[model samples]
Target: MYGAITAVKDLALTVRQGEFLTILGPSGSGKTTALMLLAGFISPSEGDILIGGRSVAAVPSYRRDQGIVFQSYALFPHLTVRRNLEFPLEMRGIKASERANRVDRILKRVHLKDFGGRMPSQLSGGQQQRVALARALIADPPVLLLDEPLGALDRNLREQMQGEIKSLHKEFGITTVCVTHDQEEALTLSDRIVVMRGGVIEQVDTPEALYDRPATLFAANFLGEANLLEETGSDVQAERSRPFGMVAIIRPERLRISTRGAPRSPDADQRQSVIGMVTDTVYAGAQRKYHVQAGTRMLTVREHVASGQQVYSPGDQVRLEWLRSDVRFVTP
Candidate 1:
């Protein structure tokens, strides 16, 4: 329990065979600690870790038969790419000829066949990341652990690496557990996401379910932008009643903005509308975000940028509407 503080208490998680699961949380949420415990880098005080139905809580990190990639890439600065990839095989007492063949095949698989003679310092950031991943998988470990694997890359490189990681995971069919605070990364790469808070699991579900129907207010806001309807000081209209101590929430993209008193959707009977003055408008490349002040609450609305679409500016009165069925009740 780390003296007086408990980091990741009563944690029980199961990762299916060949499934990609991500542990997502912000700082101080115990995601890293949980990963460490799984990796055998640290022992849990109260629970055992099972891999393939066998307890490994007392196993050392190196003997756990798992591959790990850290945020720093962890490639030896003085070693050539080929040597770095061969290190894992050598540690397993493999013959020199076989290690060379495995190294060549893996380097070619990662599209770095010609860069084997180069040192870590000579390669670009993306190239170094590839080397790290290749080294981890060269041993054919059944499970893989990634600790903020893309945190060191820039935006464009990170996106590229995400695609690469996804492709490799599909090809290898290895069970993987990733720890990251990046919401977009979790949503893009995970088959299921485990949301953590205060050293406990907040929710666990598929990415779509977690985003579409978060059970808690913390999860709703963490996954994406949420509009709290009750704070508008107006009655909220929904298809179902909200439970006690719960609030109604709608995603920003669910709200449609139009000119005041404009034509409504075909199913007008099932929709609700609200009028508000535009407080701010943001133009992202592919979409636009609008902040509107309706009564006492500021609501956000997002829309894709399309041709012939009406635009709203600050101080402009706009009508925001959404289907009553789109509203979801969540715990605060």
Candidate 2:
């Protein structure tokens, strides 16, 4: 019951009462389908979804106590923001006075108290999103399911909303599950990130663990940019091969650049250094990214350029060195 095309596969994930878990994957990776199953929008073809140690596979969609916010604002066009926020409570038969009190509290929490009388079309994109969030939070459900809720906002607004959502989560300690393809959003917002590939869970860990010691090549490359260097039999014989089997994963920031023609240190290990020519350079506000051609592989390195220091240009020959401890071994 996930996605447009259903492919039945077993997936097991557990969420604590107030944990902020993010389900991260590319499109068609079954992340949205997973969320849909938990929200009771779609039932699994097989297997059960449990809540509070009880199986909820048979629970009806309307009966499940879950709050959902989608990528689109999904607000009613004719209804004012106040009415939109009250719809969920109205469905639950809450008293008008109680609903109004809850709605006002949430409207202020989302910073849309003044915009409550305005229509969804009358507000900015960010403000509309805040109203949608208020609508979801009005019910105070135990589980909050968000499907790319910030995807519609611009870059600056998206960042601002991310912080707002994080602060709200901390304030209320509500259990949340967010699905997104954006890696940076997952890293910044999630207490634990669940990486998915080909409709299955690839790895689950903290942001630092996923970035620093990815369990697989897919995990390493998916979380961020990683340069994979193949090691031949001769390279293995030369002690350049990693322990995982076939390739070594090096993070861009872990690489160190040294001027060519310098004497090698007597204690330097040959496997930890490579001679390469800088083929391209891209200036990032805080750091510069250099594309270095080493043998048949191209490696990316990020270096911070001080205000007064000279910057490296394209085609500059340099030696790339990194400590063995910085190298992550991944299976081919």
Candidate 3:
């Protein structure tokens, strides 16, 4: 709590051993604060943090058996990569021989054995990132914490590093908690995700479950493109599966768009159809997105770009349909 402005309030979470958990949220959502609290950068006004069923709320950051990788890489500019990797071990009082061995093994593990003699300034962004990760793991800490570790890389590099992080996690089987605002990063890396809003946990579930079955409108909209069907409610009022006091939302990918005169599917009776005019069309590399104006709501539809598939223009009329079961109801 900073000057009475509670950054995170009543937060409760448990990360299982060897599980990769991600705390995802936008700016001011308190994800960083939560990570800081767990890292012992700041003490929580209330509630205790437990590691392996043992309370460590009062433990200092350095005393806790945890490794951390920051977004900046945070390598010492003057130190060689090998020296940076060895720093953590030296701090922990590991002998010189053991430190050198551990550094060599870790550098090889990150595929940077030969680059160790170079200073941090000599390495590229990706190389520096690997060095940081290796430095964090050189001491073999029980837990790993990542604070937007890939934020400094470009799109392609970020994607590449995501695979690297996943492979390392699988190999090490360390319980890791990462904080990031990137939806794709969270979706791709997390075994389970905790979505926070306004300092409170909005939802917690597996990546697939969180995206497919969000419990609130904020989560549904935050994770991906959720088309809120304001007028769609009337079309599917007879849907017995829809709960009371909920609004309907469907993913842009779940919705299909066809020409206005196109024939209905064989299971038309089991779907909801709406007529709308295309407001815009986007040609993504592998997929196409269409913005359609239906009733009072503007809906976005995404489909793979396939051969022989008709492309709609801005003025073209289109019909959108989706399976009744695809319509998820979430709290407003």
**RMSD to the native, candidate 1?**
1.0
Using all chains and alpha carbons, the TM-scores for the candidates as numbered come to 0.98, 0.92, 0.97
Tens-digit per-residue lDDT, 1-332, candidate 3: 99879999999898999999999999999999999998999998889999888888999998997999999999999999988988888888999999999988999999999998999999999999999999888787889999999999999999999999999999999899999999999999999999999999999999999999999999999999899888742466325567888988899999989999999999898888888999899999999999999988999999999999898999998899988888889999
Candidate 1 vs candidate 2: which has greater TM-score? Answer: 1
Best by TM-score: 1
Off by over 4 Å in 3: 232-234, 237-239
Global local distance difference test of model 1: 0.94
Best-matching candidate per lDDT = 1
Which of the predicted structures, 1 or 3, would earn the higher lDDT when compared with the native? Answer: 1
Go through the candidates in order and give each one's C-alpha lDDT.
Answer: 0.94, 0.84, 0.92
Error of 1 at 178 (Å): 0.2
54: Cα error in model 2, Å: 2.9
Candidate 1 local lDDT, 263-304, one digit each (tens): 888998999988899999999989999999988889999999
Give a tens-digit lDDT track for model 2, residues 1-332: 43465543679888878999999988878898899889987889889998878888999878888888899989999999999999999999999999999988998889888988999999999998888888878898888899999999999999999999899889878899999999989999999999988789999998989999898888898899887755311132223455635467778998887777767766576346778888898998889999988888888999897787656678888887766667777765
